[model samples]
Target: MRTAYSVETVRAAERSLMARLAEGALMQRAAAGLAAACAQLLRRVYGSRLVLLVGSGDNGGDALYAGARLARRGAGVTAVLLAPERTHQGGLAALRGAGGTVVPGGPESVGAAEEAIRRADLVVDGIVGIGGKGGLRPDAARLAALVGQSRAAVVAVDLPSGVEADTGEVLGPAVRADLTVTFGTHKPALLIDPAREYAGSVRLVDIGLELPGQAELEALQHADVAALLPLPQAESDKYRRGVVGIAAGSARYPGAAVLAVSGALRGGAGAVRYVGPAGEAVIARFPETLVSDTGPAKAGRVQAWVVGPGVGDDAATVAEVLGADVPVLVDADGLRLADRDTVRGRGAPTVMTPHAGEAAALLGVSREEVEGARLAAVRELAARYRATVLLKGSTTLVADAGGGPVLVNATGTPWLATAGSGDVLSGLSGSLLASGLSARDAAGAAAYLHGLAGRYAADGAPAGAHDVANAVPEAWRDVRG
Candidate 1:
């Protein structure tokens, strides 16, 4: 798992490292890493031109020092000082000592800088960092706007200028970076949305900062995800391994049941038992699924239950499923009918997966609000329902109740947004739950594998629901390998 520290945590860690290092050691380390990254951007560094958008803080100091390094390597480097008088003296001196020059800042100066940027291979953004309050200052904002329209590749120093280092919220215009070289630890903004969208690619540079407490947010790596997956044992039987019971669909919408069963069959569960009016359709599509029209109460025993994909607003079915004493996954129409008190009181672990539209309904907010700050929305949902919550979108985020690390899913193609994809995800996650994975792990792994399956199904072309479902086994095999 990749750990993300909040701005406050980053500040604390910086302080700890600062105490142990010599004067200006931390900045030097940051500058050196920044310089290396910039050098890589300019393939033939010897004759390439580099532009630095210098501000009035340590961020500018980093850019200046990096410019000095580039100048030393025979790259022509220029620093456009946003705050001429207040710029870091040490950094300025270092740049001049290495044959780099600093220029004034204004519309005419910005035009000259833009010309330099257009001719240069890369632009180093040092306009702001963790100390920034809201967006870019007007002058900085204008320069960033021009850079966005330029051909030069933009590299951010520490964090992207104009992006909230803490909340991942963009108060106003923000610089779009092709790559961001961060220091000490990962900032929450780098992993979350809005700000994350601006950060094209992120690379961490170790500054030896010691952080305390738990990570506010995180993303699971391939190995970490593999470890969380359920592996069948030799002695395990269908019953012993785990059984997943799904209560989904109605005669009106039978596809939901089929899609849900499709995912459940490919998920980690040893067996999947389907109970609903769509049993005939599910069985028609997937002959392996065990079918029953009995209520959830009489669906026999199951290690976990997945309720409501197309069951609609049927109050009766919702109540019966929620009353079960096992891990449960609630999705689609089920979200609308859920009660916080009942979900909170359930003895078993509950995972709620909702798209932005559904989440908007549950939170009494607009879909725009949820999409703008997906991390915050997921965390809020988890805390509100007192259950594990998975918010699905461009970035799928899973958050657990009582404050735990939030996992962000970075995989998946635009094609995964097709119809019934979510149903497949719900069933897959329910199967993992039956197989005894925690709600957080089940949701995250499901999202990851579902995306992989979608990619396989599409292969760069448009695909139908069944295509994605059919690719699950192959995706699973690849992940296992």
Candidate 2:
């Protein structure tokens, strides 16, 4: 798993490592890594025009020292110092010794800096670090804008400047880098976000800092997903594996039942007991499904239940399933029908899957608000409902009410925004819940597998909801292998 730490945690780790190392040793290690990455990008470092946006902190020092290294290797390097007086004096002396020219930054040198930025073959953004809050200052903002206009590839130090490192919020003007070389550990902004979009591709440089405790957020890798997958044992029987009860679809939309059943069939469940109005449609598509025209209460014994995919006006069915003592997953119209108090009162675990629009409705806010601050929205929904929330979008995030790290699903395609795609996800996750995974694990694993299936189904082409559902077994095998 790829984990991300908050800025506070990273800073504390840095301090601990710095106390044990020589004064300049840590910075030297960082500068060496930065220079090496830049050198690789510039292929021919000799005669390469390099411009470093040097600020007042250690980030600026890193850039200046890196510039010095490049200059010694026969590159023409220039440093535009944003804070001349407060700049790292040692780094400044070293740059001058290595034949790097320095230019003062502010109103007077804006033109000179812009000129250098336009002419440079590469631009290094050290204007701000992870410690910066809000947005870029005026001097930095103008330079950031120029970097956008320039054809030169930009590399950000630590993180893209002007983004919240912990929250992944882009408050104002922020640097957009082709690549970001972060040291020690990954920052939250580099992994989540509106900020993550700014950090194009991230490269971590180990500064040998020891980070303790849990991460703020984590993205499951192949190995992690493989371990979480439920596999059948030699003596496993149908009932022993677990049965998933699906309360979905209505006379108005029978396809929802068919699609949900399609997903449930490949979701590692021993059997799927489906209940509701579209029993015939579900049976037609998946003949193996145990179909029932009765309510969820009459549906045979099940380890877990999936409620509401296309039950347009069937609020009674949603309420009935919520009354059950098994783990339940609520989605689509069910999110609107289920009583908030009853959901909170349930002893069994509950999982909510909502897109930005649905989540906005639950929170009484605009869709833009939820989309703009997805991290906050997911956590708030999970806490308010006292359930695990899977916020589905371009980036799927799963948050638990217990307040641990949120699991981020990074393997999805734009083609996944199909009509019945969410129904498949609901069924898949519900099946995993029935198979003995915790709500958090079930939601995270389902999202990971769903995204991979989407990728496989799409393959740069348009794919429907059934295509995604049909690809689940392939995704399952890919994970297990």
Candidate 3:
């Protein structure tokens, strides 16, 4: 798993490590790593033009020191000091000694900074660090805007300036980097959205700081997914493994039932017992499915239930599923139809999957608000509903009501956004829940597989919902391998 810590946790870890090391030793280690990554990006270091956007804090010191290292290797480096008086003296001296030129920041030197940015091969953004709040100041913001006009590749130190490291919020102007070289640990901003979009490709540099406690967010890697996957044992049978009850679709949208059943079949569930008005369509598509037009109560014994994929205007079915003793996954129309009191009163685990628009509706906020502040939205929903919420978007986040690290799905293609795709995901996750995974685990694992399947199905081309559902087994095998 790729774990990310909050700004407070990273700062505490840095302080702990700094106290044990020599004054300049820690900076030197960070600078060395930064220089190495720059060299690799530049390919040919000699005679290359490097511009360092130096600010007032240790972040600026890191850039200055790294620039000095590059200058020693015959690269022409310039350090544009945003705060001349407060700049790191040791880093400034090192840069000057290594033949790097320094330019003052502000209105007087704005033209000079713009010229340097224009002519640079690479620009190192050290204007702000993890502790930075809101956005860049005028002097830095002006220079940041120029970066987009230039052809130069921008590399940020630690994180892009002007983005909140903890919340991933971009209040104002922020630096967009081609690559970000982060030290010690990954910050939540690097993994979460709006800010994540600014950080193009991230490279972690180990500065030898040991982080403690639980991570704020985690992205499951292949190994982590493989471990979470429910593989059948030697004596396993359909009934012994688990049964998933899917209460989806209506006479109006029978395709939703077919697609959900398609996904459930590949979810490692022992048997799929489906209930609702689209039973005929589901049986026709997947003959193995135990179809019933009755309510969830008459759907036989099921370990878990996935309700409300395409059950339009069928609020009763959603309410019935919530009352079940087993875990239940609420999605699509169900999110709007299910009673909050009934959901909160349920003793069994409940997972709510909502896209930004749906999530916005649930929270009584605008879609823009939910999309802009995804971390806050997901957490708030989970807490308010007293359930696990899987906020699906560019970055899929699964948060539990218990307040632990949110699971971020790092897989999938943009092509996954199609009609009925979310239905497939709902069914797959519900099956995992039936297979005995916790609400959080089931949601996270299902998202991981669903995303991977989308990638496999779409392969740089447009893929339909059925293609995504059909590719689930391949995604599972790939994870296992």
Compared with the true structure, model 1 gives a TM-score of: 0.97
Comparing 2 and 3 on lDDT, the stronger one: 3
lDDT of 1 by residue, 424-460 (tens): 9999999999999989889999988888899999999
Q: If both were scored by TM-score, which would come out higher, candidate 2 or candidate 3?
A: 3
After aligning candidate 3 to the native by TM-score, how far in Å is the CA of 206 from where it should be?
Answer: 0.8
**Model 2 bad stretches (over 4 Å):** none
lDDT of 1 at 466: 79
- Note the Cα lDDT for every prediction shown: 0.88, 0.92, 0.93
Q: Which candidate is the best by lDDT?
A: 3
Error in Å for residue 156 of model 2: 1.1
lDDT over C-alpha atoms for residue 367 of model 3: 98
The stretch of ten residues in a row with the least summed lDDT in candidate 3 is 291-300
Q: Global CA lDDT of candidate 1, please?
A: 0.88
> Which residue pairs in candidate 2 collide?
none
For residue 372, give model 1's deviation from the true position in Å.
1.0
lDDT of 3 by residue, 278-305 (tens): 8888988899999987788987999999
**Candidate 3: where are CA atoms >4 Å away?**
none
